[model samples]
Target: MSAVTDNLGLFFGGYLRSLSICLWALVGSLVLGVLVAACRVSPVPPLRAFGAFWVTTFRNTPLSVVLFFCAFGLPELGINRSFFFFGVLGLVLYTSAFVCEAVRSGINSVSAGQAEAARSIGLNFSQGLRYVVLPQALRTVVPPLGSVIIAMFKNSAVVGAFGVGGDLWSTGQTLTSARGLETLPVFVGIAFFYLMITLPAGAILQIVERKVAIAR
Candidate 1:
């Protein structure tokens, strides 16, 4: 009991650091996702092609591979990291590709008539999308987006394989190595930490979905 209590602070500090990275990754992914969705839906062939390529490439590639490329390969190309920025960057870009598909599906769920009605009211395409279309689409996508964020948060642990410090899994490894403790407690602690992040996010998404349904 004393051992567990003794290491609790260390465990929590690492969990919080990882959570912060996850939150930043979530925001970055959402913004990039919105842009990619726009590109996918655009009438221009080049834009559509670019979006398709991005989504396919990133979605199909493994997350760890992407992290390795960005964290290690990028440094060779002159990109340096002050902290664990590259790990977060990799999570953002890789996860954003998946988010883009989710957002695009939500956009498709909005009927063409909605856009047409906005256009008939004298709104331009961009204006209609910004005001009428995207709001609805975003509302519809909140649940899925939340799921993506939770998954991204969990997966952030994988960065530990690349020597990224101060994350939950990395902390577990450090603790286990130092104390020669059994793996079960360390992993259980990690799972609890992840649940702390995912559950609230899931509840918030459910609330947003209900609100959107009411608005509709």
Candidate 2:
């Protein structure tokens, strides 16, 4: 307790850095995921196949393996700076697979009539997905998307294991070692810090989900 109280600045700084990593990772994953989901549902056969392959490949891989490749393996191939960016990339690459699946499921949930109606009005596949289907699909996907985000928040801890600095997991390790092993207060404080982000986020998404809920 005394250790944590004395080192408030360190904890806060680490948490802030971790939050930044998660934020950027989340944004990138969502964007990539949507594009992948679009590919999975593409009217063109090749695109759909490629998208399915992408999801299967990443989803089958471990996050640690992906991080290792980004942080270490890529440099051998002259892909530099991905070491520092690995934490961000790790979350994005792994999470996007799940995100794509969630969005695709949402797309499936939409009634076939909607697409047919759009087609009747001359709205082709791409156009309908862009202007009509994705919007409705997003509403259905929010709850699952929220869950994915929360999982990403937790997974951000793995970044620290890869030596990315100023992350909460690394900070916790440093703090515990610097102090004695009896750092209950430190863990309690950390849990509080995590809940600070997750609880509010969950509640906000729940509200957004309610608002966006389809009438069906």
Candidate 3:
């Protein structure tokens, strides 16, 4: 208990690192996920096939393997960068697969007539998706997407294990191993910090779900 209290600043720094990783991963995944979703729904056969391949390859691959590849594999190919960069990249790549699927499901839920209506108004495919289909699809998938983001918050812990220093998980390790603090208390503090992020997110998502339901 004293260890946790004395090292509050250390633990807080770690929490902020984890938060940064989550935020960066979330933005990257959402952008890439939307593009991939567009590809999956594209009229172009090659685009659809590419999108399918991406989803299959990443979605089936374990997150740890993906991180391993990014952490150890990329530098061999001359893509050297910080472990933090690689960690975030791996998270983005892995999470984007799930995000793609979620958005694709939402796109499927949208009425086909919506696309036809957009086309009838002289809108191109890109314009139709941007102005019409995606807007509605996004609203429909809000809950699922929220779940994905929440999962991402938990998954960010893995990044610290892969040499991205100064994250909550690694901080716990430092306390337990280096500082010789009691493991249980250190991890209890770590769990508390994670819950701090996820619980409020879940609450906000529920509120958003309610408002969306009312709007519908």
Q: Of the candidates shown, which would achieve the greatest lDDT relative to the real structure?
A: 3
Sliding window of 10 residues with minimal summed lDDT for model 3: 207-216
Candidate ordering by lDDT (highest first): 3, 2, 1
Q: What lDDT does the true structure give each of the candidates? A: 0.85, 0.86, 0.93
Which scores higher on TM-score, 2 or 3? 3
Give the alpha carbon lDDT tens digit for every residue of 172-194 in model 2: 87888865545687777677677
Error of 1 at 107 (Å): 0.9
Better of 2 and 3 by lDDT: 3
Model 1 lDDT per residue over 88-199, tens place: 8899899999899999998899999999999999998778888988998987787788778878978888866677788887888887897787777777887787788878
Candidate 1 clash pair list: none
Question: What would the per-residue lDDT of candidate 3 be over residues 11-130, giving only the tens digit for each residue?
Answer: 999989998998899899999999999999999999999999999999999999999999999999999999999999999999998999999999999999999999999999999999
| Range of the 10 consecutive residues with the lowest summed lDDT in candidate 2 | 178-187
lDDT, candidate 2, equals 0.86
Query: Considering only N, C-alpha and C atoms within 3 Å, which residue pairs clash in candidate 2?
Result: none
Q: Model 3: residues >4 Å from true position, as ranges?
A: none
Better of 1 and 3 by lDDT: 3
